[model samples]
Target: MTNPVPKTAMTMREIRHQLGHPVPPPGVPDAEVLPVRFVVSSVPEGHNARHAYTINVHYRGEGMYSVGHGLAYADGDGAWSYEPSRSGEDDEHDADGLTWIAAHRFELTTALRLARRLAPTLTVRGRSVADVLADGSPTAEGTQR
Candidate 1:
């Protein structure tokens, strides 16, 4: 017997519509879409492990444009996670406070592809601002910075 193929989850357009965000213009470069699925695992520390989540963002540009995935996590007990895509490094809390080690960005296409891959594992409930934010929430918050 042959195994059945899985159906397509959602297209970039469909996802954007579902999420209530405007889709990027056709052929537009460096356009970004949000609320991609990501997973979080903790890094062992003194007693607790640090949790982090991955996010996919799209960027359209000229010669070099692609989608990319980013890691984000909380800092200490802050409300927001320090986004790796923005900082470009692993943010850490030290005597000097929050410091980012890396600074990286992603392409729009790459991010869309990653989001498509991760959508299956992502759980969705209602359509609300908080829900959207929660859906987009990173597994962990950034460090003290």
Candidate 2:
């Protein structure tokens, strides 16, 4: 039977449910998008006289991620701060400090792609992020510097 409601009329949650995506528990407001919680820092290692910066990837309920507003770097004065994206609302934060919304609440693959573009040397337990993703275990704790 065809669905009576148009696809556009259905909420993302409803659409996801119909498509067999995981259904969030009752009363979870705006559970459609997942945001990353932990912060991922990008350190420039094995580079020639390179500066360092940080990028926080908040991991939402699923394998979804919300990349930070902009790269966090030390200014000329050497104070660390977020550059803040030129695009508004690129970095929305919730009460728990997670980015509320991003240009894309990227899944694992997409998130890794963005990470690789920015932090190619990002590694967990000395393994490349790609390798980690290949093994179906991207949840390894970010090694503390």
lDDT of 2 at 11: 83
Candidate 2, which segments miss by more than 4 Å at Cα?
A: 1-52, 69-102, 120-145
| Clash count of each predicted structure | 29, 8
Residue range 27-131, candidate 1, lDDT tens digits = 765465654443322222221122212333433234222222233422222222344333335344341232332222234444444444543333223333234
What Cα-based lDDT does every candidate model obtain?
0.37, 0.47
Model 1: CA > 4 A from native: 1-81, 84-104, 124-145
| Best-performing candidate as measured by lDDT | 2
By how many angstroms RMSD does model 2 differ from the true structure?
13.7
Q: What is candidate 1's local distance difference test score? A: 0.37
Error of 1 at 60 (Å): 9.1
True-vs-predicted CA distance for residue 75, candidate 2, Å: 23
Model 2: per-residue Cα lDDT over 1-145, one tens digit each: 8878755578888888999988888787664454445444443342221223335555754566655424443222223345343444444433223332333467766665565455544443476544433554312243322
Which prediction has the highest TM-score against the true structure? 2
Cα miss at 50, model 2 (Å)?
Answer: 10
